[model samples]
Target: MSQRLRLLSVLASSLLLSACVSSPKKPAPVEDRNPQPARTAAPASAPVPPAPTAPEPKPAPGAENAGKPGYYTVKPGDALIRIALDNGQSWRDVAKWNNLENPNRIEVGQVLRVVPPGVDAAAVAARPIASAPRAEARPLDAKPAAASASAASSAAVTAAKEPAVKDKDKDSAADDDTLAWGWPVANPVTAGFDEQRNKGLDFAGKPGDAVLAVADGRVVYAGSGLRGYGNLVIIKHNNTYLTAYAHNRAMLVEQDQVVRKGQRIAEMGSTESDTVKLHFEVRKLGKPVDPAKLLPAR
Candidate 1:
């Protein structure tokens, strides 16, 4: 009984030592053969869209705006270059608008159309006139405040040097007695007067077209008495002027018939030439003057 007790005590001491020396550990959980995927940062936000823009409005037709196409009458002593420069146009544009073969050949009393910059006729006419700059000639003293006093004084001196304006009515009446001439017909001049050929100005027209008197005059002759002219009408305008319309289809006025300017005295016909044309002549004291020089510029 004593031997059995010694063995039991030894076993109990071994168990207590084992329990104190180490603890039982659980087995690790089964691991996945494939590794977990790495995480990625989110993409940057999309750029903001731009704002929408509005379209410009178009002008209406036939409105008179600041920049508009307009017409100007050519006065005496106006050349094409001068007209173009004055109207802010190019010589080429003037020539093209007038259908002029020669840019330098412009006559007085002709009307020229000027177009504004950067704008066409439709746009210009549609624009308002109040928006346009005033074209009147300004006084020299009304210059910018920043201008020097000497500059203003110079401008004043320049203004003082300009010639005084003359009354146009008085000038016209004074020039009236000088025997002004007019176009004999309402047609275009096809051929010009030539001194060497003795051919007078030729007007383009049909037979029986009325030929009018250039100025107030009394008919001196109305017959084909002169050679080379099939039918003729002659008028004595004044002491210095005697005008004739030859190659007429018929004479309307008799000898000594008083006719005013633009009065019809005969009809146009081709009596001398095959083509239908009026042979117009202007004589200064029995001498032939260039019909072109006597006729009013169109």
Candidate 2:
């Protein structure tokens, strides 16, 4: 019995020792390894940048010279010869006036002096405006003796008043005083001058009818270079006036040739028009005037 008791005690002591060795220990308090994320809300997404702005556009070609005096802004497709023709100036004179080394090298948007250097915008504006001649109405029962006396007194008064007429009249006289204007064509009244539509007179005739010059002048332009004026002839009647004959079947005059009033310069045709016709234009300072007003009464 004693031996059995000693063996049981030794087994119980070994079991207790094994339990103490295998039991888990309390873990050391764990430290927080990572910090908390930022509390503030993420900044609002960057503002979307505005779209790039467009640049301003440029103005029309000749808009810069609108209403400007004596200065003509160059337009696209404008040739020096055509410019001179429209302005009633000699191309060489214009070239020299502008100091252009090359007449053919004119640039768009360039301002050109169409008149002489001494002649300014005021002079250009002072040019004459041609109008139809006015007739005075006589009293139906007036006596011839009374009329004669009235005429004599009226003449005396007119001489005193003549000096103070608008400067335009004097300017016109300066240009047309020596020119004895004659009718360009005998046939009349197919179409008349309209500032908006027709710039001059048009007469219907056969394809080879004679086209005459209305006044003495030098031919500055005689060719088909001007558009809408096929086979055109331009005459520089004087410093202030020019005449254009267009739609000709043939041009008889040449550039720099002087022509007299009633001289046949071209043969009428429908070069640019629909039917056979003569298109006559009278220009003062590059602006067209009514030929009927300037032409002598038929």
Candidate 3:
């Protein structure tokens, strides 16, 4: 029993010594001299939007004639009589054919039939007024405002300076006949063609002075129907050319009457003008050209 006690004491002593010698504390963490920074993702950039652009104006209604024969697209400032004259038809006939309750109440962009039924519109041998606004002229004799379209009308016409040719006008451009021209009056020109103001030549003359036909043509329009014209006359020389005599005291020739160049067509007077004068205009494809370009040199 004494020997067993000695061995047990020795084993206990060994365990006690082992317990007293604890494991060496871990070496202090070595200081890092160089450290790599942690990587981070960049926020996505916003996309830039494209710039907006302006939209083009839509075409007017009835801009297309709908391929209907004898149909005319009424433009701004179109007088029924003027439409009739342009198409070589009487205003009454046009009114009858269209069954217009009030001929003067036509609307802008309204399509009109200027030719009677059963008649070939192509054989009318006249150029329709350009689809653009009809060219306007200021009268020398009337007040500045008086030169505008008739007060009774709602829409007034203004000139289109340097207008581009329309498809309809272009179609007839190649077929228009070149013609001889003469002066409509023998008076000093008081005013000349101005695209912005005066659209034709103004001749200072006395009342009853003879207004001559500038070319041999049929009288397509001879009446006091147009505003600011005052007993005006429009002679259709050909499919492409026409001449206008405005502010006449008396129209000697009638509509549909054929007149020769240098023949007296009207007596010059202040009808819609301030002074006794003759306002002469030359239209090619319903576009006013400077009369000086067509008239003979004096």
Give the backbone clash total of model 1: 5
Measured with C-alpha atoms, the lDDT of residue 79 in candidate 3 is 75
- Cα lDDT tens digits for candidate 3, 1-298: 9999999999999988887787655778999899989889998999999998889966543456644667887767777777765665556567778778776677777777766677776775346745434534222122222222332121111112212222211111223445777899888999999866776899998876778888877776676666677778887776567788999876666666666778777777787678889998887645667999778789
Task: Please say which candidate is ahead in lDDT: 1 or 2.
Answer: 2
Error of 3 at 190 (Å): 0.9
User: Model 1: which residue pairs collide?
Assistant: 63-125, 63-126, 64-127, 65-127, 65-128
Pick out the ten consecutive residues of candidate 1 with the lowest summed lDDT: 136-145
Model 2 score (lDDT): 0.68
**Tens-digit lDDT track of model 1 for 1-298:** 9999999999999999898789767789999999889989999999999998787754332223323245555555455533433333334555666577765555555555654334455443321112222222222112112223543454345335532232211211213357667789989988887765654788899866768889876665565544455567777675345677877766666655666777667677776668878888776533466878767788
Query: TM-score of each candidate?
Result: 0.40, 0.59, 0.54
Separately for all candidates shown, the number of backbone clashes (residues 3 or more apart, or on different chains) is 5, 0, 3
Among the numbered candidates, top TM-score falls to 2
TM-score (C-alpha, index-matched) for candidate 2: 0.59
Q: After superposition, how far is residue 168 of candidate 2 from its true place, in Å?
A: 27
